[model samples]
Target: MWKITYSIVGYDPVEKEWGVATQSKFLAVGAVVPFAVAGVGAVATQSYANTSYGPEGMEHMSSGKSAQETIDLLTSIDEDRALRQVGMIDGQGNAATYTGEKCYDWAGGITGKHYAVQGNILIAGTVEAMAKTFEETEGTLADRLLASLAAGQQAGGDSRGQQSAALLVVKKAGGYGGFSDRFIDLRVDDHKTPVDELIRIHRIHQLYFSKSKKDRIVPIEEQIAETLDHQLTRLGYKKEDQPLLHTFKDYLHTENFEMRAQEDGFIDLDVLEHMTRS
Candidate 1:
């Protein structure tokens, strides 16, 4: 008597790959429903949260199992015998998913290059619609995942209604300090419109936290100088000081310029230059 829907989008820059997978249950399901390794693979385990399927599925893929073979092996070994669902995508972008013989009313999945989207106990048409929407949407992997979730909702998602949603994406050197990077990892553990809320947070991440494509960064130039001057004036800095503003190198050489800027709540020239140009 439970219904769940989930989706995941993952990318590995080192391998130049992208993928998606999903499954669900009524509990905080996506936590177990989706698993991903930055440069290895992604998996989704559901239909009563067969959590082992996630890691084990990835293991099979890592060992050179084709996506279909991995799913077949996992299904063959499941103890429940007739209540499980799962999906996977490997570094090569091969994809596969499964729904057991005795799952609830409406449950199944579809796989594709770079992605898979699925749901269980959903309305008759939602799962495939989600997969189709994901396939058709444009933009980053994150955008396509969100679109798929939205489409599922539009087509009557989770027969029981919404509670939680999550997203995870990873790439090599994608984390902070390049020590650990998750391109996108956000969740709404419980919410009325979890998918929409997740989308809002994703937009915020793209605007501020996400690293821009290398081509998107505009070099600091004279146009930015004027913009910085205007911004400083609006923030109550003396307009006269605009011209006297030194380059970042000059500020670094000054004894307390950095501290002064911090105290005044003004961005350093280097940051201002980047922001204004961007």
Candidate 2:
């Protein structure tokens, strides 16, 4: 019966990404918390989490149901409705939330433009802190969601203490290799400092998977080519013991910079930045 506390479910209209982030005193809270579908919506179910709310709720939104309507329809049929807590946001960024009357003290939620923030069995201001962070923090949906969770924890968070945390976001072709909608799904199932661990993992995820911004991308100019040639030589990749773009490309391939450059052609500025930064 471990209850979760301090979670945010939100949408990024610019990126068309839906995300949910949660922290709890429960072990493996990620298993029962955040759920999202690309071009559909995101949901968070806690306080006697009926995991069914995830898939079933997405089905409702997919069928053209608004978040509030979907919540009403689902709660209308559940005999144990009063024992649940949930938040939802539809594809268009409309939002809704609910906290059962029987939820433990310090339980409630806030819904706003493109987002819902909620918690149960938490400190009095935990959910409020989360909402404030989500609104003030600027970045991708994943970045804001994770910041909200961290803020909640700093605001006292679950009175019972922290054990698990999760961040899940979805968008069209956001999954590995453009296969699915699961853009980012990182969980700290059991950790002494779960929120911190979640942040660390998220950074690593973006490093390997996220493309550098289009504006920040430096084209392979004369100076950049020289940097690459020098760095590749220092890294022990050489063609005929001399500078070659092909050798540099091979190094980029090993470092997962395929997105920043074409193996046969020009180099990306990010590749040089990454090499130097490392």
Candidate 3:
């Protein structure tokens, strides 16, 4: 009487490789639902929390197993034949997913060239809808994964109602400083709209946390000094009493510019916008 929905997209531009995987459960499941290895372009998504497949599947992919081969190996190894569902994608774009007969109602998946989407115990006919929406959506692999999550939400995600949602994407040199995973790694443990909130957080990540495209240092030029003076004056620091402004500037330069004039109990920038009219 529960459903879990998830998706992953892994792209490595240098290798020209891409892979996608997804699975779901009733709670804020972690690597249990989906896992990806950056260098290999492989993903393992197991439902009913068949975690053994995660590492084992990666092993197969590392040894050059195609997605289908890895899935077959996992399904074949599970002694309790009717108690597992798994999906995998490999570097070569091959894909596969499995739904054991013993799984709860309305559990299945669809595999595509570069992606495989799956869910279990979802409301009505959500699994097919989720898969169809994922395949139809266009954009970066990350966008397609997000679209899959959106589709799951639209099709009545998690029959028990929303609690948490997560997204994980991987690629080589993706992480900050070229160190770790580069794409979305967001989680909403409990919310009225977990997926929506996840998307908002993802946007925030894109803005400030991803990578600095522009140099952040403000040049100490005359025009910039004038702007700083204007900002200080609007805060009620008169030009004659601007001796305090010199001290503030000294503090700014001395402290690595960590001190902003606005934070010194002066005019708030938000208020400054209104002060222009006043």
TM-score of each: 0.74, 0.84, 0.70
Write model 2 residue lDDT over 127-208, tens digit each, in one string: 8888888899998888999899999999999999999999999999989899988999999999999999999899868877
After superposition, the stretches of candidate 1 with alpha carbons farther than 4 Å from their true spots are: 1-3, 8-27, 212-278
Query: What is each predicted model's overall lDDT from 0 to 1?
Result: 0.64, 0.86, 0.60
- Superior by TM-score: candidate 1 or candidate 3: 1
| Decreasing lDDT order of the candidates | 2, 1, 3
Largest lDDT belongs to which candidate?
A: 2
Worst 10 residues of 1 by lDDT: 256-265
lDDT of 1 by residue, 95-134 (tens): 7777777877677777665666666778887867877887
Higher-TM-score candidate among 2 and 3? 2
Better of 1 and 3 by lDDT: 1
List clashing residue pairs in candidate 3.
4-24, 4-25, 174-182, 175-180
Q: Which candidate has the top score in TM-score?
A: 2
Superposed Cα deviation of residue 261, candidate 1 (Å): 14
